[model samples]
Target: MSLYSRKAARLQLNLRKVAVKGGLAIGAAQAANAALQAAFIVILARLLSPADFGLTAMVFPIVFFVTMLQEGGLTSAVIQRETISHRELSSLFWINAAIGLALALLLCAGAPLVATFYHEPRVEGLTMASGGLVLLGALAVQHLALLNRNMHYGRMAFIDVTAAFVGFIVAIAVAAAYHSYWAIWLRGFVTIAMTFVLAWLLSGWTPGRLAPVSQIRDLIGFGGNMTAFSLCNYASRNLDNVLIGKFSGEVSLGLYDRAYRIVTLPLLLINAPLNRIITPVLSRTRDQEERYRNAFLSTLQMGLLVTVPLMSFIAGNSKGVILLLLGPDWIDAAPICAWLSVATLLQLAGNPMGWLYISQGRSRDLMLAGVANSMFICLAFVAGLPWGALGVAKAYAFCAFLSTPLLFWWATRRGPVSLRNLVGAISPFALVAGCCLVVVHLLQRSRPDTGLLFLMELLTASYATMVLTLSVTRTGRSCLAQAWSVAVSGFSMMQMRKRSSYG
Candidate 1:
């Protein structure tokens, strides 16, 4: 073979190796995180009241909005910047710090008002205690972005997994001993402190004073537009919880919040990593429109390959699954979980498209799309409030479905992913899910006495295995081979290191 051909082959091998390592690291980290969180929730659910969970949930959106303000898209600006100066980085850090301080103070001040609105005076103390979480979150924001930009996902994964495990352990311990909402608040507090500590240790970068006055304007011009879009996007995403907490009271909100958490399980495992990895990768290729398009489509296809069947099986067997995981008291959340699964599936579709627009520096397009969607969703919430949380869930799902086309159009206009191609890629998974649902229905009719637990476990396992067998026939096997090779090599290397150390 020619020298050039050999070089090309070597490069391909290296790329595959990197992808495999990254995937494994992310997959392992997410699996660990999910397990710890699931354990925490199970323990907390039994120890604390739904009203305690609801109170915690009610504070989340406000804290989230405050976090958005602190973020102000500066981290993205730092990551996507062609050339980042020390001055600029320091300026960004302080900007975040200042905003965080202000946000904390504001949250503390508004504690009483928030408590009054919720008709629970206890919320004042809860809100005040949770206020510092925003500051902690802001302090770590830019550092985490810097880690991402440097492709230090292995370190990022370590920090994340450690923090989650620590937080979970603390939460469970606190709940078991105290059995109050203090456990929930302590979890947030621990998470923030660990985040700051990890970011500082892992990033190994320190900042000084702000940059030149001129730098601030340019950075904000880019970041401000992105932040505006993020604000709307955050609102659209969290509006249901916002409304639920306001109209339905804390206990109802707790039930719905728990259900929503269950619904986003697949999303937490799959979409979270994609959302992290895709932006920087896409940003590097933003000038190459074809590469950008292909990468977007491939990520979308891969995301759906996992998300679709997972959502389908979970939704189709929500009753049994909820009972199994959350126990008998949460049977009420079963239908809500089912309804939320649909919204999450659509979210799986739309999330990567945000990466596309952001990588292309089309922040205004994202902002506009976000605004339009938020408005429609807010209208839906107003119209659906009379029917309660179920109506709100349906409204949110409907809004998500309506917004899918808008997202598709935005992505397609800028890339080569046709609507037909997108639909075609996901068809097989959809078909499998449809078949599984049919089988479920038939089995239920024939064996009317079949337990919810048996049916849920059977359907989930059966459908998931079918999807994996069909989808992974070629690509999945290839990935598995690469993963196995990597694992074996890593094990061998560790053994050699131990022998060398002894010698």
Candidate 2:
């Protein structure tokens, strides 16, 4: 009675509390995962060469794009739907299983071609390893979705953290033993494989006999549009790596890839956890305009609060961070990291706009926006090819920010969340972030030879600026109070649960 059977009557009554606790649970898990990942990347960078990372980066876009499409976008559909049946879920499960196996074989077959495309012979085998990871991911997507649909994030979080820990131990051990990039690929495979095992165990789900395909036609329709968006957005975001690798070579791609991995850590931390909670929460509240609007805006502000300062510091102090994390060999990645951080800030501004679209069943809009954005970014890549890796970085950042306004208008024009709402929510943080970034950039230039102590001062001054700005404004105070209450309430709720279990 897993996917086919869930009793959600009581859960429907207090989605707010569920969302709040779920966010806290997943947030804590991701924070741990981020720390693990950051350490892994840093250590691996010192042990391996840039070309090692570059080869993996080259094939990842294709593998990741398929990963997004494997569930046929059914996971989010399952979460957002008002009702789903056992038969329908079972049908979706079998469908996912079939697609996964087919995609695995396809990736394995195409590995040689990927190797051919980049003129890098080593990637052929790496792509095949990624195929195994794909198969594991497809098998578990439905089970994980079942858990997500019911907002069982506490259990899911525990499973996720455990998988990440296992991946960390295994990857590092392999890297230490083999001194190869296979360790990086193994990290992906092990994490997905472990998550699949634990998800089935903890998801309390056992798929029943398959139902007729007709029963899930509407779900397929919903998911198909999402799949289209995934395809376009994948091209938009990942094509840069492909372009750089193919034209500028592995060393260039590797440096850019390392810089990118380091700079985008905060975005992943904020986006991944909130995404798990907010999509389902917003989906449930979509019928209530006020509740829906408040939930989306509150989530947007909170994310910006974490991301802006972090991105600003990284963009402004890329040199110090590079030296500290990756050593002198990767010092060349500093400017590339800075530009990528700017692009990330722009990309992140529209991240939650996706929650708005999915909750409102606007996948078609999402797809169109993705296509248009992809077209522009692709042009930017082509235009920058003559200038090598740094040129590509600069061009990508400028084009992404240029395209963001249109994306905002397109995403919010018809929804309950309007353009004005989004602009207002982001403007204050943007202002504060810009000021702090400028201040830090000037200071860093003036003290070019300073060490970690200087980084501390910059961090302190950045947060101080944010706090002062927020403290002075009514809206900022409201947001801070709301954030504080959520934190306190989530902690209290956990303690109560522990006490009840002990009794």
Candidate 3:
């Protein structure tokens, strides 16, 4: 090959290498997080009443809203920008800190309103306690963004896993001792604080003196658009909880919240780490159209491979999973979980489109899309509200399924990615996962027993079927081979590092 071709080939190989390593690192970290979260939930659910969970859940949306304001998407702007200066970083940092403090105080002041709206006085304390997360989250945003920008997935994963572990320990201990909703509140506070401290320690970049603030106006503008998108998105997603708490009461909201948590756990584990990895990687490769397209397709394919099967399994076995995890009191959440699992499955297929918009500087399109999506979601929630939590869940899922195609079209219309490309990438995995889901659903229906063994049998059959089918196909075999190679390389690299340290 000529020198330019050789350079391009090398760059492509490097990208693959980084992606593989990053995926493995982040995947492991997220898996650990999932486990910890599951354990925390199981333990806490047993200790606390449903009303306690519902009370805590009511405060989450408010805290999340404040958090959106505090970060203001400045961190995303930092990562997407090809070049950034100390002055810009410093200015953004100060701006974030100011926002964080202001929002934290605002949450404290508004705690009473939240309690009054929910008709539960406990919510006020929870809201006030959770306000500190805003400042802590803001402090760590730029640091985390810098790490992501530099492709420091391993370090980022370490910080995240460690923080989560620490938080879990504290929460578990506190719950064991206090046996109150304060466990949940303290968990959020401790986790955010730990994350902030570790991010600063590992990032090793300090803010220099702030320079002329004029340089960061464009950054602020970009971040503002992102923040607007986030606010709309947050409202769409959380309105259900707000309305449920208002209309249906705390106990029902608790059941619904738990169900939602169970269904979305897989998405949390898969989407978060990949998003952190893909956004920066795609941002760097935006100029290379073919590479960008291929990279995105591959990532989407990988995501669907995991999400489709996992969600299908969840939907098929929702009753067993919910009963087993959350106990009998949460039985009402089973149907909700099943429906929401299907919804999440459909929603996840279109999740990676954000990378395209953000990386390509299509923030305007992203904002508009968010607005449209939020409106649809809010309407669905409202339509389902009169029917209670299950109705809301069903309505939400139906709307998600209906709007998913439109979401894909809008996200891909003006970008390198297209609907055809997306369908092509995800079609095979979707087919395989669909077949597995059918078999699993049949097995569950035939057995009609919700026990640990039955659940295990269903999971095993589903996974084995998926594996056999995938192994039978050339495309599936290639994906498996690539995944195995990455896993082996990651293991060997860790082993070598351990040996080097010993020597």
Candidate 4:
């Protein structure tokens, strides 16, 4: 083969290796995170009232939105840049720190306003306590980005899982002692602080003298757009909670919040990690259009392979899952969970649209799309607010379902990825997932008893049916073969490393 051919072949092999390693590391981390989260949710749900969770949830969006500013898209900018200077990074770091401190102060000052708007005095304290997360997050944003830029997912995973575990322990302890919403607030504070400390340790980069302001303007410019996009996106996603809390009261908001979390748990476990990995990988291959497209589609396929069935099962067994995980007190969240499941499923299906925009340097498109998305979502929230939390859930899900096709078309219209490619890639998984949902739904009806044994049986049947269907079809077989190869590759790599260490 020619030198170019040889280099191309090597790049392909490296991509596969990275994919395998990243997937395994992220999978392990997500599993641990999910388990910890499940424990936290179960324990907290039983210990605290829905009002407690709802009050805390009301403050999260505001805090999270401010935290996004601390990040300022600078990390993404770092990851996407072909090359970055120490000075540029230092400049970004200081800027992030400044934003973080400012936002923290602002949040603290605005706490009373938030409480007033919610008509709940507790929100003031909750908002103030959570304000520090922005500064803490600022301390780590760039470090985490650098880790991602270098593809150090294993270390990143370790930091994330450890932080989550520690935070959960603290939160549980506090809840047991105080039996108040402060426990949940403390969890957020602890998790962010721990993550910041660990990220600095693992990233191994220290900021030196700052770069000249003019030198890093391009990086800042890129990040500014990204931050703008995040602001819009954050508003759209959280408007539901804000509106629901204002109109429906803490109990209703709590039900909606818990239901949303349960439904999106699969996405948090799967799509989130995939997105983190894919961004850097795609950035590296941006010049190789075919390779870039293939990498994204492959990642999307694998992500859906896991997420689809899990979501379908959740949708089919929402009541049982809620009953088992959150206990009988949270049974009211079941219907909302079911609706949010479909919304999350559609949301995940369209999420790759983001990978294309970022990897291909389409921040402008991303920002514009964010604006449009926020508008649509806000309208839906307003329309549903009159009916309370359930109304909001139904409206949000309906909007998401309605927007999926439009989002795909818009995202792909200017990128290397096409609407046709996306549809073709997801069609098989969608069809099979639909079939599995139907089967699971029928079985669930037949076993209407929500006992542990019956729920277990339903879950087992759903997964089994999905696997059988996949094994029986050509596309399904291909997906299974691809997954098997990645798994085997990951296993072998682990073995080699172990032997080397011993030797």
Per-model lDDT: 0.75, 0.86, 0.86, 0.87
lDDT of 1 by residue, 1-503 (tens): 99976875575455444444565667679889888877777778889887898888888887778888899988777767777887788888888899999999999999999898878888788788766888898889889988877767788889889888888889888898888887988887897789899999999888887788797786787788888887887787677777888999887788888888888878888888876776777776666555556566666666666666667767666776677667788777878888887778778777777776677777777777778878887888777777888888888788787878777776657555566666655545455556655565555556643365666566666556545555545544443354356568556655776899999
Q: Any runs in candidate 1 off by more than 4 Å, and if so which?
A: 1-16, 416-421, 440-503
Better of 1 and 4 by lDDT: 4
lDDT of 2 by residue, 267-369 (tens): 7799888888899888876876776888899888888888888888888899998998888999899999999889998877877778988888887888888
TM-score for predicted model 3 compared with the true structure = 0.96
Model 2 error, position 300 (Å) = 0.7
For model 4, the run of ten residues with the poorest summed lDDT: 458-467
| Greater-TM-score candidate between 2 and 3 | 3
**Inter-residue clash pairs, candidate 2:** 4-86
| Candidate 1 root-mean-square deviation in Å | 3.8
Candidate with the larger lDDT of 2 and 3: 3
Clashing pairs in 1: none
Clashes of each: 0, 1, 0, 0
For 105-163, candidate 3 gives per-residue lDDT tens digits of: 99899899988887889889888877788889998989888999889999999998998
> lDDT score of model 2?
0.86
